[model samples]
Each structure stands twice: as structure tokens, then as C-alpha cells.
Target: MDRNTVEKRVRELNDLLNDYGHAYYVLDRPIVPDSVYDQHMQELLSIEAEHPDLIFPDSPTQRVGGEILAGFSKVVHEFPMLSLSNVFNEEDIRDFDRRVQAGAGHSITYICELKIDGLAVSLKYENGRFIQGSTRGDGTIGEEITANLKTIRAIPLKLTEPITIEVRGEAYMPKKTFMKLNEARDENGEEPFANPRNAAAGSLRQLDPKIAASRNLSVFIYGIGGDGSAYGQDSHSDSLDYLASLGFETNKQSKRCKTIDEVIDFIESWQARRQDLDYEIDGIVIKVDGYEDQEQLGFTAKSPRWATAYKFPAEEVHTKLLDIELSVGRTGVVTPTAILEPVRVAGTTVARASLHNEDLIREKDIRIGDAVIIRKAGDIIPEVVSVLVEQRTGDEMPYHMPDNCPVCDSELIRIEGEVALRCVNPQCPAQMKEALIHFVSRNAMNIEGIGERVVDQLYTSGLVHDVADLYCLTKEQLLSLERMGEKSATNLLTAIEASKANSLEKLLFGLGIRHVGEKAAHILSEEFSTMDEIAKADAEKLTSIHEIGEKVADAVITFFNNEDVLEVLAKLKSYGVNMDYKGRTRQEIPTEGPFAGKTVVLTGKLTILTRNEAKEQIEALGGKVSGSVSKKTDLVIAGEEAGSKLVKAQELGITVWNETELVDALGEKE
Candidate 1:
């Protein structure tokens, strides 16, 4: 559109937005669907970009942001976003009361609220309109993700009162939304999100407002940012009321306390009842209610002394370890898998789980006969907790790695300086089953509504075995399986038909050779450009490739050299499994830079690169990568829903950088 047309369009949008704001805010009614409002706002942005002169002061886009900021400019809090002092047990609460008595010499009141498991965000309102919103980046400074924040319907675009205030709260997704998102992603052949916290953080930082809008995000206002606006109230409880008066979506779960004992009661109640809540809450935040008491308790450079968060125990579940079985992969690595008594853990009913490797098995002392415990550590990944050694049987055997391929009966060998036992057998039946399973996995082949059960059924029924067998399955064959209706069989066949045209890397990943994970497969496919090139590559050349150490190189070389593997490849080729690789290595990567001398801890989900891909990039940039965040970390690439590492980064005041910032830092010559 022309500049004049753009200007005319923006004005019209602004008028419509103002009416919607009035209807939704002061009037307590919404005239448009949230999605429609979001789309209208996006339309204004596209127009304004081409005609900068069309941008107006009162535009809805102006509420979000202008140019992208290099980083957040620091702004001191009108009142500190104080850290809560903790009370681990009842005695600690009594101690807090004793301290309050010594200072106030009178009864003290407290306010308790759910500490939502999400990144803290601060939103500022000026003269009845939303002005600014940002992350709690380093407490004092945060990135201006205003455009994305504006897309969240829960965050009001305008306020009811003609008063300025800053609101502090958690930005999180509901449990229902999290599940829906995961399901949708799985259906679309994308990786499922780890958890709600991760889903929320990822949605909020989206560069495209449309992505943010599609997520259906929400937030809760916890506190008013300062003393001025809370009307005749000098207490924390009153501040929340003031925020509510401004039409913010404040949680009604907060309770006003008459004493520290009452505060403890509220905390304990939530602590017990948190499991029933729809959203994940990591803890409860308790604060001294009065502003006068807050000042008396006042500031440390790092945190305010007024409040503290009481963290919940990690999610734990216990079930019997029926047995430990050895599972041979397509690469013929005999890893131990724990067969449990079919207990539900972390939303999935896990009857079997990976023991990781031989080293981990030995370290955990996990015996087949023991009653084992499992924990979803930090509500994310599930791992074995500990074995109830007292329940062990005298007949329990000490586990050992196999000396020969359990499937192909080939001599097994442990690579130098590694713990896993490898079969290195290309024709191993077990590896073929495992690899074929992985390839047809929902994330890989995206077979609609198909899971391990369906895959196992297909394998058992002899309708499929290797990756290429999927191409040979007939509708008549699929319909013969139990519970497989004609409609479902047709859908499965259609999905399988579509999967034959998947990218070459996916087909490579489906092969599941030892040490060749999805990321590694992608790298190999992109580098070699064809299955023939990869099959022909020598060990030394394979090892020379990035992230392919000697062990992985040996495994890859050994697999390709086997005659059976060549025959399997020929079969796959006949059935049209993609053998043509088409990825270009970003060849201009620097071998030395500031990152070269650094040790970085990557502890969260990267919104773009897969974890292994990020690890490779970090190594290529000349940095050593560590799994956990620590004091020794020179830099940390903080990503969506960063966990303990983010806390550690804050504790040390380490240079915690985001992916975008990390890329920019790499762009620097130094």
C-alpha cells in the first residue's frame, strides 16, 4: 500500500482498538474475539513497517515496541522486587515471627500467593493505558518483548483507572493448554514441548506476533510496583487490590494473614493442594504486608528482605523394578532398559525406561529384583531415583555388559575411553527392530495416531520390520490387526505413504546406527549429501567431521562396511526411502573467537536448534560445553524455561545470555 493509504489504515485501526479497549476494560465486556483483535493489531504492524511516517503515538503497536533493542536498559524498581525469606519448617516460621516481633514490637500481618512456575515479568501502565512490559532479566534489566507480550489476551491493553502503576506477576500456560499444544505438535510431526513452563516462555519470546497469539497464553498480576497508587493502603494485600482495581487478571487464591502462623498455614495448604491446580506452581511467596514493615526489613543488593519463596519438593513416584532387560539398537549397542511394573510417571505410563548406559546402571546400583523409585526431576525428564536396596533378593545377579552381539552374535567391543558395549553388527535383527521403531516414531515418520503399541503390532504381525517395510504395507494387512478398523488402517497407510517422501536426514535417523542420533544423522546427511557417500566414508574422515568423535566414527564406519547393511540400504532404496541428502554446512564458522576459550553450560530448551545441534555450534565456536550450569561457566546460553542453571546464573551474577544475544556475541570478531 502507498504511504497515505497506510496512514489512513492505521488511524482506522487505532479507532477500532480504542473502542475495543473501552468495551473490554472499563465496560467489562469484549466486542471482538481475542484472535480477531490480535489479527487487526498485526495488520497495523505490517502497514506501519512500510510507511514509518504512518506510525502514530497512540497506535496499539506503540504499546508493544518500536525498534528491536540491543539489550534492556536498566531501570531501578520504584520498590524492590524483593526475594522472600524462607521458612522450610514450622520452626522457621516461628523464627520469622520472633524477628518480626523484635522489629515491629507488635503483631505482623502477611500475604501469601501461589508462586507460578514461569519467568517473572513486569508490566507498567501509565494514565489508564498499558505502556511497557519486560522480563525480570537480572531483576533490574530485561529484554523488551513488548510486541509478543501484547499478543497475550490476559494482559490488558488498557486499564480502567487513569493512574500509573507497575504490576509484577508470573507468565505461565495452563496445564490444559500445555497438553493441547503437545498433541497438536505431535500430530504435525514436530517435537512435543517439555512442560508448561517451557511452552509459556517459548511462546512469549516469539519474534513473530502471530506465533505468540496462537499460543493462547495467560498471566496473573501479583503485586503493584509502588506505594503511590494503592489508595489508603500501605500493605502488600492492599497493593494487589489496587492492581485488581486497575482491571489486571490477579489470582483470587491469595490470602491475607493476621500472623506468621497464618502465613505458614496458607503456605502449607497450597503446598498440599498444589497438585490439583491447573497450572504448575513451584512454590508460595510470602511477604510482610505493610510497606513500613517492608522498609524496616529492607534491601540487599541482590534481593529485598521483605519476602521469600518456599519451593515444593520434586515430583516423585515409586514402582517395582520387575527386571532389567538388554535392548540392542540398530547400531547394536546393548543398553540396559528397566522393565517396571507399569507405573504412570510424568503423564506417560512407562513400563520400560532407558538405563542410559552401563556406567549409569553400575553407579545407580539398579538391580533387577529391587523395588525402584522414579522421579520426574523438576517436573521435566523422568530418571531413576534410587533402589530400595533393603528389598533386594539374594538371587539377584550383578548386571554385566554383553561381550557379544545379543542379536547378531558378533563379537562386541568397548571403544577406548567409553562405557557402552557395541555390537557394531549391521545385520543385527534387534537393531533393525529398534531403528525401524524410531524411524516410524510419531516425531520421525508422523504416522497419525500410531505409537509404540501400533509399531510393535506391525512388527509382530510381519506387516513391517525395516524402514523400507513401511512402504510395503497394504491396507488389507493394516486392517487385519486387532482394533484396526478400515478407517484407521486407511489413515495409517496414508501416513506411511506420505512418510516415504520425508527428508533424507529423517530416513538416516530412522536407520538408528550407534551414536547416530537425530542431530548427528542430520549432520551426516548434510555433509555427505547421499547415503552412498556416507556408506563409503572412511573412519578417519568420519572422525574428522565435527561432533563425530573416534567412537562414533568407528561405529559409523563399521556399520557401512558390513555386507548386510548394504543389502538393507538396497531394499530401502527399492522402497523409496529418501537416500538423497541436501543440507549445506554453514561453512564460514569461525574456529576461534571469544567463545573459543570459554566453558558454557547449556541447561534449557533451545527454541531453534536441537540440544545436540546447539552443542555442536558451541563446540564449533571454540567453547567447551558442560551439561549443568555452574560457577565455572564463562557464559550460559539461557533458553526457554531455564531451570536450576538460571537460578545459579542469578546467584553468581554470571553473564546469562539468550540464544539471539549469543548469536550476536558470536557475530563479534573478538
Candidate 2:
């Protein structure tokens, strides 16, 4: 095709793709299937590659994030992102309404919106094309996050008409995404995020755009950045409609109320049903609708007088702490749970709450028979917030954690650098049960039809004693268990049999070793081809590998040195379990290269490869990658906006190379 034909086709494709994207993302409606969209996108990408000069700033292809950034640059907002005044109760709402009425000398209309629990962001557009996005930093200046903002599919790259505008919105992660992220983090041996709001904030602040993209962030535009009159908008509600018309995602739940009483009703309705929504909301924002009314109301020094936020009262209840019960985990960590008097909290009847550990109990000074304030953390897990000291009576008894395991009467010991007490007894029935559950978990051996209920029944019936004994179950034995029929028993046996062929990493994790997690298991399995080899490795050998620290190495060595572990390994081998590591790690890695046998520290961020992807390639070529900079570092791979690690490398006189140099050394063509 000629240049003219290519240009015409590109324009057509862009229009079609943008419409489809807006429908799917902003509108939550898709006109075409994903496959159809992908096909058209492929055509667009091919044409753009062939004619790079024809690529426009708002091209759909630009959404696929390009480079990793070392750091975010600062952005100054054209208009100050003012905060709203807050109201706590019905009296405060009535007072605010009275003030507005007195100032205007007439009745007024109010717009109520759900105040989303998320990070605030400002998006700027020029000529109907998205030009930049920034965080709400100190209201005047913010960090540039254009690349990260682009990853949010709800954010449109181009508007419906060629109009310049700046909009403010809340960027948030949905509850489902937050749960999945925490689950993955737990499996990877990383600390779990406390709540969805924190997760969203951390994700948006990530220097790497790909990291932010993977977080599944979404946004809901609430208001224009500056004066609405410039856009020919008369009211806050009208501006919201205008934003929606421009293909921006706006909260449809926002309602225009004629009086403060209607606003109170709206707030009460949401407070009753807020949990039903997929996102979290901490409050309701009430704004005087008309721009003229807002100006007349004017601004207080720190907040807008025309707008106020009503924070929902936290759901908390007073309950007596009856007793503390202990439960042991698969890894032998014994956790204390508080037995509480039955009470209602956040629509659920609560009788128990996690104490976390003894430290929390001591910090709160909780006592048996004392009244404690309990609330659900993140509206999910019930926990004791604090003790109501004034409610304590003379009969209250100070609580103390048991020095022995509650299940087996074995002495408990606190491991070094750990907060919880552990029962090291290998024969503890509670540990055995927890280990069995972990063995069949989705992230472990992935054995289906074997849940905690089945594990409990099997343990109680004397059919399974340890992890190795799972393969020894018979059809008759399984059929005897409660709720187990012929079909279910057959399925359970099949799943158990299938798990025997899992890779060495799964089996290693299933064994319930102390400090070795799924990631460490994978690394050890890759370094050593067989289970016996890993078992035979000394602490020094384990510590020499990348990402394996002294504590983990010692834990691995201590676990494998046990006679009971040897017996279990032998039993598993006899049961036909695959003891050899079968993974792509070894076969895919090149043995010799310029990076081979070198310790590389990748600092800042690379433009091309993500941190994980770069680590894989380096490890594949026999190079070891460390997380931090040290004197032992052989080379530091620096990218744009390199930080302390790069400075440290220079101070230490260590070699440093930019991303291009590393790419050249790897013999890869640009």
C-alpha cells in the first residue's frame, strides 16, 4: 500500500480500536469478542511497525507499556487539587446545610458521591489526546505517572472531541484484585498488603510501569481539575456527565439531591449496602451543585466551603474476652485466637477473632473477662482492636500464652528472629493435619477433591498418617469416610495418584520445610536435578546460591538432617513419587556467555526488560543476580534515573554499564 493508503487505514483502525476499548473498559460493555479485537490490533501494530513515522501520540498501540522508569519526575498541577471539609454526623450535615442556606438566602441542591478509598490522580489532555498524568502530591505538585496511568484501561488515551481538559479521579484496585495479590504474595513468601487502598497506592507508586500494569488498577473521575465554567459546565453533576461523554469513567451512583435530608438518606443507604460493591468507599462527598453557588460559598484555607465529606463510622463492638485458644500451623507456628462473647459486627455474628501473637496481646494488655473493642480489619478478618480499660473489673485475669503446644503438650520454642512460638515435634497430630492440608493445596501439589474436611476425616479414621501415606489409601478405605461415595472416592484416589508426578519443587514445598518456600524450592530444584542431591547439600552449598540466605540454608540443612525426614523420603520413593527435578530452568539456560560466573546487580530500571525478565536471562547465562549493591558486585546495570545503588557502585569503584551496553554485551541486536 502507498503512504496515503496506509495513513487512511491507520486512521480507520485507530477509530475502531478506540471505540471498542472505550466500550470494554470505560463503559464496561464490549461490542466485540477479545479475539476480534486482537485481530484488528494486530493489523494496526503491523502497519505502525512498517510506517513508524505515522504513529500518533494517542495511538492504541502505545497502551502496551514500553520502558521501565528508574524514578518518577515531578509534575506541577495547573490548578490546586483542593481537599473537602469533613462532617461526621447528622448534626454536622444539618449545620453545613444551614450555613449554605444562610449564605445563599435560599434552598440549595447538593450532589452526593461515594468517596472512593484510593489514591488521587490528575489526568491532563490536549487536543483530546491524553498528554500526562500525575499523583495528588501536596495539592500543588505531584509525581508524573503517565506510563503507569496508561496501563489503567479505564483511562482513555483520546477523548471524543479535540478539547483540552484536566480531570481528577481516584485510582483504586478492586477487592478481588487485592485478594489475589495477597494470596500470590503469601505463596511467594512476601508480606501481604494490609488492604486494597494500600495495595493500590503502592502499585501506582511503582517505578516500573509493567509492575503497575500487572496490578489491575482502575479509576473513577469525580471532578474537573480547574474551574468548570471554562468547559461550559454549570454544575458538579453536569461536569460529571460531560466527563462521561468524553469517554471517562465516572461513578454512576452519584445522585443530585434537593435537600440535605435526601443526602443523609443516600449516605445511610450506601452505609447499609457498601459491602456489596466491588470497590471500597470510606465516605460520601457532598458538594453544592452549581458553580455559582460554589464561588459564593468560596474556599476555606485548607478545604472548599462548598463541599464536605461524611466519614462512615467504623463498625466496632464491645465484647468480653472469654479465653485464648491456640492453633498450630503446618510450619509449627502456634497462633493464639481470642474466644469472645457472641456479638454482631458488620452484619456477621462474631464469636472469635485472631490475636495474631502474644506480642499483640501484651501490647493491648488484653485480659480474660475484660471488655475489648473488636472490629473487622479491612472488613474481612475480625480482630481485637484494643482493651476498654475503663470496663475492666477486679475479677479480670491477665492472659498468658502457653509455653507448650496446645494440641500435643510438646514444649514450644521461639525461633531466632521470629515473633511466634513453634512446636518442633514432627509427630504432633495438629502439625500432621495442617501439613496434609498444605500438601494438597492449589499452590503445592494441586491435588483436587482433597480439602481440609477430607483431611480431617482421613486423619480421624487412621487412614493417613503423613504426607507419604496419602499414596497408600485404598478405595475401600476412602469409601468408609463420611460424605465419600463411590464416585468421590474414585476421584480422590485419582487426584492423589496424579500428584505423584508433580515436579520436585511442589513435593519439596509439600514436605513442609521451615524456611523453604515455593520460590526457594524452585531454585533448589533447578540447581540440583534430584531430591537426594538437595538433601545431601550442606548449609554452605545452599547459601552459595543466589537469593538463599544463611537462615534459609540453615533451616533447609536442619530439616533434611532429621531421621524422620529420611524415612518419609524413602517411603515416598518406594511409592513411585518422582524424585527428579523436571523443569525448564536448566535446559533453557545457556552455560557460557559474557555474563557467566559474574555477580550482577540490576539497579534503577531498564527500559526494555522487566526486573524479573532480566533476572531470568542473566541467570540463564550462569550469571548470579543480587538484590542490593555491595563490594562483591561484579557489575551494576544502570538505567535512566539510577539512584543510590548506582552512586554506591561509583563510590566503591565497581564497574557500571547502561542498559544499551548490557544489551550489546549479550550480543542482542537493537
Candidate 3:
């Protein structure tokens, strides 16, 4: 085809695909079949490949991921993304309503929306073209994740009108997607993510855009950034409607309440119905309907006075406990699980519940074949609430803690001052599987695509037996596994290879050493620059460090002294796994600049630097930036419309600097 013909066809195809995608994803109406959409997309991709110059940022074909980013850059929001104060019960909601009424000096209207349990992000558009997307980091500054955001089909790449605006939204992974993702992780021998919120956050923050693309994330634009007055929007509800008109996906479940009573009713209605929805909503956000009312109420230091969130109470259900099952963890703890009759709870089927320890089981008087109430602890883990002794059958049996490991048949022992029954066998198969899963988890090695199912397949197939064996895995071997294609195997190999460059803290945490969490791993990495130093250090040397308790020190000492651990360490070292910490070491800030070594708190609005910019600058010059003012605060940077924090700083006799003075101090530091 000629250049002109190709250009014309590409433009036509772009519009066609974009319209179809919008109709399908945003409006939830599929005007075209999957085959039709795929055919056009393939055509667009082919044409784009032929002529790279024809490719545009807003092109429909660009939704698929491209390059891997080194790191996310910081972005300053045009307006602060202030948090909403939480109201748990009816009384708190009434008090908030009363305060709002008093501030406005009139009866007020409110907009109630489902507070989606997901990551808050801001999408910026220039002349109706999507330009940037960032996280709500520190309210003012956020990490730019434009590439990752582009992968979310709900977020439009371009608007219908040529208007410049910034909109705020919650990017979420739907409940179904989260479940499928966990199922995939289970198949791959990886640890399952706790909730949809965490999975969404992790997907958006992935260094590789391809990872985010694979996650099937969605977004709901709530409101525009900065004052809605500029957009000729008079109310928050109107702004939401305006966003919807501009091809942005806004939650349709939102309601405009005439009074606080109506708002309470809305919240109550949603509490039961939220489970019916595909996405998760932790609470209901109530906002003053009118823009003027919002302005009148204004904001406090941390949150806007015009808005509040009413968190839903935990949902519980009753089920029958069938039997007790024991499973060994990475640390060899044989945890008892209550296998229950299948029952619907918290929007999912609950077949098993956590029985923390024998003491708790006895305390609760739980028995097999007894009817027991089950509730999700923190809306994630299922646990037994109470045993219905009255509903218990005569054939119900008393539960007993197992004295030996179920997998290895080794005797289990409870340590002094510990309630957990630990299997002392280091070479237990269950322990090995759990350890491998932990090694490739998000907080550990962060090796993407290696999940629980993959680990099981590898272990059972004799392809891998330890963490070091994972690093030596061939792409051919990965391709031999079920459902692993050439492309996926290549990506997995790349991810595995890249993890070798991670800082020592990741390796430390991935090792599955008892009591060594991410924070503890970081502390250990910072304390000892090399793994050799930590391995050789005595318990006395470990305990000398702050926050390193006797228990932790002994655990560390014991972990390093194990023969299997030493062998694994030697193998890891030989395979070029970095043993030296490459992250920043903890040190005292140098007292050299105007803000040096001082604890500084910022308040109100500023014309020069945003809150995060000021914080970063102060931190750059060795000053510590704190969110709240206290006795320890050496200085408070007060900007226009300074609030309660400014008053508190004055009462504490702390030094206060205006924007101009702060600017001068920054200049002097430079």
C-alpha cells in the first residue's frame, strides 16, 4: 500500500478500535465481537510495525506493554491529594454532618460514593490526550507510572473533547481477576496475594509495563484535580457526571443524599450490596455536594473537612467444622487449619479457617462436627469466631493438636514461650515447597511468574530442589512445564536473571530465616554490609544492634549455623548471587545547612514548593520531615491558610518559617 493509503487506513483503524474498546471496557457494552476487535488490532499492529512514524501515544494498539523502566520518576500534583477522615459508626457520621452543617451554616446535600479498596492515582491530560499518570504518594508528590497506567483499558488514552484536565481515580483489580490471579499464582508455585487492593497496587507499581498489562486492572475516576470551579463544575456530583461525559469511567452506584440521614441510609444499603459487586469497597465516602459548601468547610492539615469515609464492619457467617488439617510452613511450623463445610463468606467460598494454636482452639472450645461462626480477619483471612455448643451434635469429637509433622512424620516440638508446634526436620518436603514459594514472593526476590504451582511442578519433577536451583533453570526446562509457552518462559528467565541484582535485603528475606521480615532484613543489611560478616557474627554481636532482640539474634545465629543453610549459601555465592548489600546504609545526618539535622513540619498551602517538594528539599539538606507537629519539631514551615498544626507549633515554642523564608533557606543551602 502507498503511504497516503496506509495513513488513511491507520487513522480509520485507530478510531474504530478505540471506539470499540471504549464501548466494551468503559460503557460495559460490546458493540463488536472479540474476533472483529482482534482482527483490527492485528491490522493496526502490522501497519504500525511497517511505519513506526505513524504510531501515536493515544493509538489503540499502544495498550499492550512495551519497555521495562529502570525506575519510576517523581511527579508533583497540581493540587494536593488530601486524605478523608474516617467515620466508623453512626455517631461519627452525625458529628461529621454536624460540623459540615455548622461550617456551611445551612442544611447541606452530600454525595456518597463507594470507597473502592484500591490504589489512588491521578491521570493528567493535555489537550484531551492522556499525558501522565501517578500514584497518590505523600498527597503532593507521586511516582509516575504512565506506561503501567496506559495498560488499564478503563483509563482512556484520549478524551472526546480537547480539554486539559487532571482527574483522580482508584485503580482496582476486580474480585474475579484477583481470584484468577491467585489461582495462576497457585499453579506457578508462587505465594498468593492477600487481597484485591494489594494485587492492584503491586500490578500498578510493577517496573515492567508488561506485568501491569497482564493484571487486567480497571479504574474509576471520582473527581478532577484542583478546584472544580475552573471546569465550570458547581458540585462534586456534577464533576463526576462531567468526567463520565468525557469518556472516563465513574462509579454509577454513587448517590446524592439530601441529608446526613440519607447518607447513613446509603452507607447501610451499600454495606450489604458491596459484596454483590465484582470490585471491593472498604467504605463509603461522603462529600459536601456543593462546591461553595466544600470551600466553606475547607481542609485540615491531613484531610478535608468537607469529606469523610464510613468504613464497613466485618461480615461474618456460620458453617460446620468438618475436621482439622495440619500444614507445615517455611519455618517448619505445623499450623492447624479448620476444614469446614463449604459456605459463602465475604463474597467467596470458605472451605477452611485458621486455627492459630491449640490454646486458642481449647479457649474457644471448638470441636470437629460442631457448627461454628466464621469471619474474615481483617477482611482477608478466615478464622473461627465461636463454636455453637447448642447446635453441636452428640457425635462431635474434641480436637487435639498433632504431636508430629503430617508430611515428614517427624516429631513436633513447642519451644519455650512459644505456642506454635514446630517440625524440627529441616529437609521436610512441605517446608521445602513453602520455602521456595517464599523465596520468589513479592517482598523477597520478587521474581515474577514463579508461583506456587510452578514451584510444585519443579520440585515434584526434580527440576529444582532449592532456591539456588531456581537461578540455574533453563528456558527449555520452563517450556517443558504445563501451560508455559516460549514467550512466558523467556520472560520468567529474564525476571529470574534480573533478581540477581537485587539488594542483599531481598536475598535475606527470601532465605526464609525465622523472624526475619522485610524490615528486619533491611536492618540486617544496613548493619552488616556483607552476608559473610552476618554469618560469622556471634549472638552478642547481633544483639548489640538496636532493635535486635535476644530471640531475633539467636534465630539469626541458628539459621546461619545450619548445615543445609551453609550449603545453600555456598551454592548461591557460587551462582553469582550478590552477598553484599548495595542499598543505602544508615548514618547520622550531617549538620551543615540551614535545615540540617532538624525535624521540620510543613503546614497549609504554599505558592513556591508543594508539600512533597519542600519535604524532599529539606530531607536533601539533612533535615527530617515529619507529618505532624510535636515537641520534637525544631521548625514548622507555615504557608498560606496555616491550620491547627501551625498553632500547635507556636504553642510548642517551635520556629516557624513562611514560604518566602523557606525559599530563602533552600537558596542558601544550594
> How do the predictions measure up, each by TM-score?
0.46, 0.51, 0.60
Per-residue lDDT over 1-670 for candidate 3, one digit per residue giving the tens place of the 0 to 100 score: 8999999998889878888999999998999999999999999999999899999888987788888999999998878899888888999999998899998889999999999999999999999999999999878789999999999999998898987788999999999999999999999999888789889999999999999999999999999886454465668888888899999999999999998899989988988788899999998999998876776676775788999988887688988999998889988888889999998776577899989888888999988999999987756689999999998659999989877889999999999999888998988999999999999997799899989999999998989988999989998899899999999999999999889888999999999888888778888998888899889989888999986898889889999988989999999988888898995455544478788888887777788887669988888788887655656778988888777678767888999999999999899964
Model 2 alpha-carbon miss at residue 604, Å: 44
Each candidate's lDDT (Cα)?
Answer: 0.72, 0.87, 0.88
Residue 647 lDDT (model 1): 75
Alpha-carbon shift of residue 109 in model 1 (angstroms): 0.8
**lDDT (Cα, tens digit) per residue for candidate 2, span 1-670:** 8889999999999889999999998887899999999999999999989899988867788776768888888898867888887788999999999999887777999999999999999999988999999999878788999988888989998899887778999999999999999999999999888678889999988877888889999999998875554455668888899999999999999999998889999999999999999999988999999876775676765688888999887689998999988999988889999999999876467899999888888999988898999998645579999898998668999888888999999999997878999998988999999999998997788899999999999998888999899999999999999889999999988998999999999999888787788878888898887999998999888888977999889888988889998999999999999988887656556666778788887766578887667777777677887645655678989987677668778999989999888878766411
lDDT for model 3: 0.88
Count of clashing residue pairs in every prediction: 8, 0, 12
Over 4 Å off, model 2: 317-370, 374-670
Q: After superposition, how far is residue 292 of candidate 1 from its true place, in Å?
A: 0.4
RMSD of 1: 15.7
